[model samples]
Target: MADDQLGEEYTCRVCGFRYDTPTWDGGSGSHDICLCCGTQFGYQDTVLDGVWSVRAKWAAEGHQWSSPEFRPPDWEPGTQLAQVPDRWADASVLAFKLSAPPLPAMRTSADPEAQRAEVLGRFLRDGRLTHFPATGREWTIVLEHIAAGFEPGVKYRRLEIDKLLKAWHGKPADLLSRLTDQGFVANDDQYYWRAER
Candidate 1:
């Protein structure tokens, strides 16, 4: 079936609003309800609450709807875009540090020690560290030591993992294990290389 035919109709379960396949606004697909009320009616409206809600949810989830011509829906031509501050623009690259690492299936707990063990097990399974030093004060030491070998701006080795774990001293091992398990780095004979997937 054609794409337009597939998504041509939508009905509001609450209000029983119904619209034709092709709306006057050239909306790709017709919705199942009157845009104003939750009821299904046989017409289109200038404003659609259901459509707006879906759009808002997509934006909140950091997604954009697919369109042949991509542009901000409400933005008009000749409106100058706002300039991003240099510091703010630079900070976007650092946002990856805020993300949780990908690890194998393991039970996580509110208890910090249990979480640490789970993360460490994942790390040992997925990561290979050539050098295992004794007498560790904090797991941060290990992460920093591993991060030391990579040069800045090379690739996946951002070296911010240590900084990110600074706030959670008791959970540094968990954080380190997560990073290693995620394949952010590879240790070879005391030297570390950034692992890119």
Candidate 2:
């Protein structure tokens, strides 16, 4: 017989254990052994009263699709075929497991802008910056802490500003653009300085 002509599912008759399809080497290995008990499987021993052949059993159950049915049932208008594999787990549990994500720690700050700045400043002050990290107030309120850190009458290089934001994993160019647009910071191609009043 050809590989495609075999029954995709089989059972261990001794222990009534169910065997799944595609057992490694396509369907050939599916019925070769009982996985639960390690018992050597013998398909011929399963035949009862000379009526159980793999092809014949599957065909009688309307499963073997390769050959035409030798005994297809006579059906009336409303006759229903019996359902196979009667019980299985609900899919919702599997779907939930697939879709769920791990939760992050909850924050309680009421001010959205303040909260964003706090989160943004965390990596900035973790000793990851050569510009020196300011903790406490700086970690809670970013813009003021950053502005105070800038020296008066001193032009800060764009590279320094880049290092500042890069320490926090922020895009330096984008932050400069946003700051300039808000009229609270001024910058050219090479330098940035606080325009605080």
Candidate 3:
């Protein structure tokens, strides 16, 4: 089916509320309701909170319904954000770290590390990395912050690691593992210290 027919992440045209409603009614008719505001458009607003299968469109000016006080429905317990992996650095995983590695070059001039840094800066704006285009230079770019602020053998906490790898798009474990495999960082129990010479 068409993407629009399958529904979309729609924002209420009246109250500016968002809902995952389809643009088309299955077979009978529209049954959409805005959970945010009590606005029913071709929907029975009394059943199961409300039938949410109505389509919204642009009126001559806009929607005529007055904006109601938005009340978001409660999610089912344990059904929200279950895949996030609760990576918070509370009392579980005390800290994390990565070691700096020297760039290797046996041929013509080309700073792989610098290139990685530039790419990361372009993709991860403002120290946040929600999504980025896949590229072959991922690990190289992740290595940019290696020697900048990290000191060898220092047991830095997860907060520090978060700052250093704020722009990295991969899981923190993978980044740490890569550094350890490359002999850059050493795993001392739970802390990641720089591998000493």
Candidate 4:
């Protein structure tokens, strides 16, 4: 899909709010926080499923203005949502990857902790993982770190799961799907939680 489909160049992917600047630039999010749904463009509103989850939450919460200072007196949710392009509304998983910047050369250490730290340093930014690691060992480490965020015995609603994973990666649904497939998380149709694997 064209990044600016339907003349939505400055539109919030999550709430469809128009902004002065483009939400995405050169395949990366502008990282501007949305005034309507409060979605941080590069973070919570990155992928399609994640965007949908944010929209759903905003709607469920009565469509409150995220930035009350900028909210117009006559603004309505239905009208703004109508501005969201069909590309976002009709899609399932729009796995849009923000361009991953190149990292410094690294050497694996003999110490397990050091090796893990190196892997994390390459993949994480401000506690949020930038992308899935290419190596199996590094990927498993990242997955385990993410799984640690959830409690083992407590069930989570789908929205709750999405929220928890939102800070971890842009593609929460994909992350959950991978976690479930690997038996790190289990779900019984509706509820999900960390599995005792």
All candidates: TM-score? 0.18, 0.28, 0.31, 0.44
Best-fitting candidate, measured by lDDT? 4
lDDT digits (tens) for residues 1-197 of candidate 3? 54322222232322333333431243322234443333453344223223221212212223232222222233221121111112211221122112212212111116866656655665565555544322223433544345334686588666566556544545666566556765666665556666753
lDDT of 4: 0.71
Over the stretch 95-188, how does candidate 2's per-residue lDDT look in tens digits?
A: 3334434222212368878666654544355633223222222232444444555676667787887776565445567555545654546777
Compose the digit string of candidate 1's lDDT tens values, residues 1-197. 64213323332221112222322224432222223232222332224544344433433544432221223344321110011111211232134324423212212267767655544443333244422221121233445534545564444323454544444343545545654764655554334355553
**What is each predicted model's overall lDDT from 0 to 1?**
0.35, 0.39, 0.38, 0.71
Q: Deviation in angstroms for 154 in model 2?
A: 1.1
Q: Which ten residues in a row have the lowest lDDT in candidate 2?
A: 77-86
Candidate 2 clashes between residue pairs 3 or more apart in a chain or in different chains: none
Q: Which segments of candidate 3 are over 4 A away from where they belong?
A: 1-114, 130-136, 157-170
Number of clashing residue pairs in every model? 14, 0, 5, 0
Q: Which rank order by lDDT, best down to worst?
A: 4, 2, 3, 1
* Model 4 stretches astray by more than 4 angstroms: 1-107
Residue 193 in model 4: lDDT: 88
